[model samples]
Target: MSSTLHAEQPGTSSRGTPDRWESQRSFDELGRPLRDITFTVVDLETTGGSAEGGSMITEIGAVKVRGGEVLGEFQTLVDPRQPIPPFIAVLTGISNAMVADAPPVESALPAFLEFAAGTVLVAHNAPFDIGFLKYFCEQQGRPWPTFEVLDTARLARRVITKDDAPNCKLSSLARAFGSTTTPNHRALSDARATVDVLHGLMERLGGLGVHTLEELQTFSGRVSTAQRRKRHLAEGLPHAPGVYLFRDHERRVLYVGTSKDLRTRVRTYFTASETRSRMGEMVGIADSVTGIECATPLEAEVRELRLIAEHKPRYNRRSRFPEKTTFIKLTREPWPRLSLVKRVLDDDADYLGPFSSRKVAEKCLAALHDTFPLRQCSDRFGKTPSRTPCVLAELGRCLAPCDGTVDHDTYAAVVRQLRDSLLHRPDRVVEQINARMEALAADERFEEAGVHRDRLAAFIRAASRTQRLSALTRCPEVVAARRGDDGRWAVHVVRHGRLAAAGVIPPGTDAHTYVASLRASAETVAGGPGPVPVATAEETEKILRWLESPGIRLVDVEGEWVCPVDGATRHLALHDAVARSRTELVPFDDRRDLTPVHQPAR
Candidate 1:
């Protein structure tokens, strides 16, 4: 993008002298306007490109200007709490090491706001930088200032003939404006260059109805005729699941969302009386709306989440849910057992889960012990020299670690077995059930076989309920499901032990893709070793890689575990050819009947 000005000539002005501002004649020589106005030229070095969602600014620099002269400046480094990508480090030279000790955004935003008070904000790409500022301010519950924004880039495009310019980058603009060589990508230097470019643009556009700060702010805030046209355009959207975007006249994004009924949701914003209250003010200020429609609600939700995480929309609120949800951690001690707790501790223990609630955690632990029978007593139970093997041992619930009969290895083995059961690989349980039922039937023990069959049914029910958060899928899939504002529900399908499909489900759609996505996912996970517990950062990364793989197809489906394409069979073939390969099929919940079926050759 070009700067708003063209260079006249380079001449040293006494403008930089500390005491020059005190002379009234100096102000006149500088052609200072009589109007009372303020502008702050700002720049930021961020974690990386795409300021859409979670990407953060690591450094900010601002220089305040009035009339046509520079006044003062502000600059600071911010901690983004995420690793700066390698490409960013190479370009900006703001290394991860340099920012390791920097203060977080919460500590620096107030100071930046204080410096920017009562000023029209100006930047090279004003929308990109200011959009993040607005988002940050809103998250902190601080009122967002309605400052008039000026983009030197946009202004340059208006004045400089596209073919005549060497390049529209800030560096090119600086050189064209006769600015001395300044450090590139450094926030302060870039801010200074932007100021110089703006001054030049104003001089060139002088007599052509060039807008003043007040005029620009009014234009930026008014609901323009063009915006009405765009809203009308949005009215023609289909009433199907998808993601939608709202943009200003300059095409800067204002909001992002997903809905099962796209037209209905978008229309609601235009019709709601409260639209004037929450987002209406911003929407009214917008000049146009853009959207991308998906085939399913799940697809819409997935796309919405990805966009929100990527673009960090000023008005979008769903991206913050991951940090707010709670999970349960199981300690990995020698006789390591399970406990319902919040937050993962650094103690020597393997984390079992991140459940939605304490009640869910308790239920999971109870069901697990009932099926697998690991020790539930504390370490202190056997150390006190108990007179009899604890009640749990007498009831055949535990091996009685308290009796000193079960060896440490044997006890640890049982614990591992329990862990495997909770992880949802019930092959051992299945084998045990099959063996007992067969022995009883062989002896004509029908009643015993029936009891074993019931036990096996209970085990299947328990196993099905096991929640698989990041299970790999069989195809490249996207499922879109809406939870509460803070809750996220996703189904990942793993085929041949690899992620095949994944997605978020937007609200509404109750059949088709939702069921197909689940069945495909289950087939993928069952086709492999099933879903394994992700415990460490490396494991988490592995799961993420699988989910993000290009080969994985994300689909939106409804009702748990139903086939997405053919609904005739509730059972998904876990051993299907696509699933039998290295790809594994994993499902969110066993809400659908996924029993394996054998077909006779045609």
Candidate 2:
């Protein structure tokens, strides 16, 4: 029988990574078949139940086999340098005298490991044997070699039943399968018996279509049959950074995601690792998984956001409603009231958001009102107004342009202050809010202070986000590079804060030539109307995050990329201060506090 997989010699690909051994063979692209997988069936007799309890291995035995044929055998007795308990000596028949003349573990373990190298480790209960080996390596200060392991007991529990075997014990299973060797508590005897039981279980699993090593490993888990049946969708996917879309029978996208390794990430959906409840349902109905390879992980992230926004897949909740984003629109009217709008138009009015929710936009609007007395009412009016005066006018909270109380020039001045606060001068508004909060705190009105604090935070956060995004969006073109782990530079071109093109330049390559080619092929973006470009807010936000990351070098820039000197980004510290205040423990209700004993309901 063949003892090794039908794999070709390893060779380097264009990317300087080893070519997949499975891809060059006539096997399932997902993984090698069970028959081609070699396994080392091992057994150990130790002095105690666990390695942590000071147990040490007394005897070790393993049989290296493939396709029901034994390729090699290993057995040794180790001088544990300690006394074996009476019960353990009786149970395993290995006594101190047996290992007194044997070699010590430091001398014996290396030989067994070399013999079992490059094969899957298997045992009746694998953790017991593997754990002891790992502990020995740790104690000896030797690094443990990574090995793929399988437990015969775990596999048996999935296929065998009480009716077939009275118990999952090695002796009971040997009898049930009519093994050629019966387990007798000795290491070699038990290991030989486990080999037969492993073959028996594999034969039973074969009927269930568990033909491949990957399937066998995942078979013991709670993977659904529907999920397993769709494993073929992961075939032929490049093991590169990319975006993947899971589509239904109608070719409609069901989900979209990004990963550094396409095949590994998509394959996890078919295994038990994908535990998200909705993902299982999505996989059940998914017909195919398609991959779009990217030059860098950042590009993959940008594509993922754009795809989710474009398709609005039912499985993707994030970035699905970029169109539904509400902005605090400073309307272009004689009485420019703050209006929460969903669409950003070319009307040349000032806008402050891309806020995810209307409630947040309203809070920001309230913050603006608290600072500048822009009209709150939505009524459009000419110079001569006909609407009734509201409470805000009586309280001097508004200029009350609706009753013709304030001229357009005066209201316009207040509007300019707000616009400057939104775009150019955020401190003009933040300082006043800070002063008001201090006054409220001085009056001991802590609850009202908290309310004002949160409102100011909302405005500062929105302003900061908008300013950061605008700084990138206003720039027509930006080229940046960051070195990757493989000594290559990942270069990307941004057009109006959207990832237009991306590529990688190998070490020692002419960066200028490569960047020129990237820029030439980049997507052309026309200047948009507002401070933000035509790109979706989420897309621009992702680009800005990548740009601000450490080690990102700006190779070239077209337009000026600068934030206002008094931009909201400068007030981020104050925003974070308010955010930190929320986590602090404070009195739940200042009005109703007991002094350990309710003092006369006062």
Candidate with the greatest lDDT versus the true structure: 2
Best by TM-score: 2
lDDT of 1: 0.57
Give per-residue CA lDDT, model 1, range 295-338, as digits (tens).
44544655676576567767665462433323434556555666
lDDT of 2 by residue, 1-602 (tens): 65644444458554444667435642554677889999999998877666776668889999999988999899999998998644345445666778999898898889888998899999887877888999888888988888999988767765665567765777777898999998877899989999999999888777666778887786643557888889999997999999999999999999999999999999998886664546777899999899999999989998898899889999886789777888888888877888888877889887888888888888888899998987888776797896778999989998899888898899899988888899887886777877776666557565676677678778988988887787887888999998877878999899887788999996677989888988998898887865465788878887888888998999999899988887888766635532431221211111111112223554
Clash number for candidate 1 = 76
Error of 1 at 486 (Å): 26
Question: Can you give the TM-score per candidate against the true fold?
Answer: 0.35, 0.59
Q: What is the TM-score of candidate 2?
A: 0.59
For all predictions, the C-alpha RMSD in Å is 24.9, 22.0
List ranges where model 1 is wrong by over 4 Å: 1-35, 50-53, 81-83, 181-183, 214-602
lDDT of 1 at 34: 21
